[model samples]
Target: RVAHMVVEVPRWTNAKMEISLTEPLNPIKQDVKKGALRFVSNVFPHHGYIWNYGALPQTWEDPRHVDPDTGARGDNDPIDVIEIGERVAARGDVIKVKILGTLALIDEGETDWKLLAID
Candidate 1:
């Protein structure tokens, strides 16, 4: 899934949600606006990485101590598109929002995340 892109998450069904990228930066918030976002032939590329670490024994030394090998930080930190929750209701104003989850973006754009709930 793409790392960042404005997607509309459906309530429920079998699938998850749909997303569309806004083109043309907002110039204000320095972010892409929903208008700029498009579901056109233009497709954004996706790239990510995962740093895996091996297991160690008690022999492992803590970084805090004079010893080393504090297990070497192990985490899967990927860089991708994200949605700025701050919805826009104006034309020029730009707001800021935290990035949600990074998606493995499928055929993103003008997609729908069928709803399964009534509420």
Candidate 2:
């Protein structure tokens, strides 16, 4: 299973903003354009995302699958992840990471799971 396999971050992620890639530190309300890394507004103060974020390979969260926790459907995307480490990776650069935990986020009545891992 893709979720059980260990892989690099950037190799599986891309410049497409929403299709795949870590959530931007600053998120614009309706900025849905893909490609290139762009900065929006900061959602937090005194703290920032300290991980090389990406997603799992070959794993899809079917929008039709019902989540037991939220009783909602999946977000129809690969599982999201945040790779915690000291090294900063450029977009499309691959890096090894260890799986840790996960954060569940509900968007527009869908469940999106964010995997937390260490480098």
Candidate 3:
């Protein structure tokens, strides 16, 4: 199926930006941790994110709903997408994408699904 991805953190960037879950219109904002702006650290071989990181609008991973495959409640956020297309999308760019597949990631007892897609 086709989906629209709201780009949050662009490719090859260290800033931990995300769609503001609690804000009006859910604008993209940098995530702050411990009162400081957060930056994802490179783990071993990988640098900043290798692909465009974003979420699908109008799609929420309801915390009250459990996924049958992962058997975990949702992370209470919009479904995330990893855009693997050739072009690097900019922050806040809402690009149409074709859903290729999905990865079920259980993070801290919450189901954080990563939807793999192409622009």
Candidate 4:
């Protein structure tokens, strides 16, 4: 199946940008931690984001819903996607992607799904 993916963080950049879930119109903004701007750390040999990371629109992982497979509650955010296409997508770019596979990532005891797709 095909679905829309919002490119929040482009590949090779580390600013922790995300779509505002509580703001007006849900604009894309950088995340803040301890009243300061946040950036993701590179895991040694890798630098910045390994792929174009984003989220599936209108698809939220409800915290109240428990995933039977993972036996954990949702992360209360939209489902994240890893676009592995050749081109680097800009922030806020809504592109059509073909659903390839999905990974159940248990983050902080929450079921954070990572959908793998291609443009």
Error of 2 at 20 (Å): 6.2
Q: Please, what is the TM-score per model?
A: 0.19, 0.64, 0.90, 0.92
- List ranges where model 3 is wrong by over 4 Å: 43-47
Off by over 4 Å in 2: 1-40, 43-49
Poorly placed runs, candidate 4 (over 4 Å): 43-46
Computed on alpha carbons, the lDDT of every model, listed in order, comes to 0.22, 0.58, 0.91, 0.93
* Residue lDDT tens for model 3, 1-119: 99888999888887999888788987788998789999988765877888899999888999999899999999999999999988788899999999999999999999999999998
Pairs with steric clashes in candidate 4: none
Q: Which of 1 and 2 is ahead in lDDT?
A: 2
| Candidate number of the best lDDT | 4
Pairs of residues clashing in candidate 2: none
Q: For this target, which candidate reaches the highest TM-score against the unseen true structure? A: 4
Where's the lowest-lDDT run of ten residues in candidate 3? 40-49
- Comparing 2 and 4 by TM-score, which wins? 4
What's model 2's TM-score? 0.64
Clashes of 1: 17
Which residue pairs of candidate 3 clash?
Answer: none
Q: Write the per-residue lDDT of candidate 4 for residues 16-55, one digit (tens) a residue.
A: 8999999889999998988999998997787888889999
Please give the range of 10 consecutive residues that has the lowest summed lDDT in model 2.
1-10
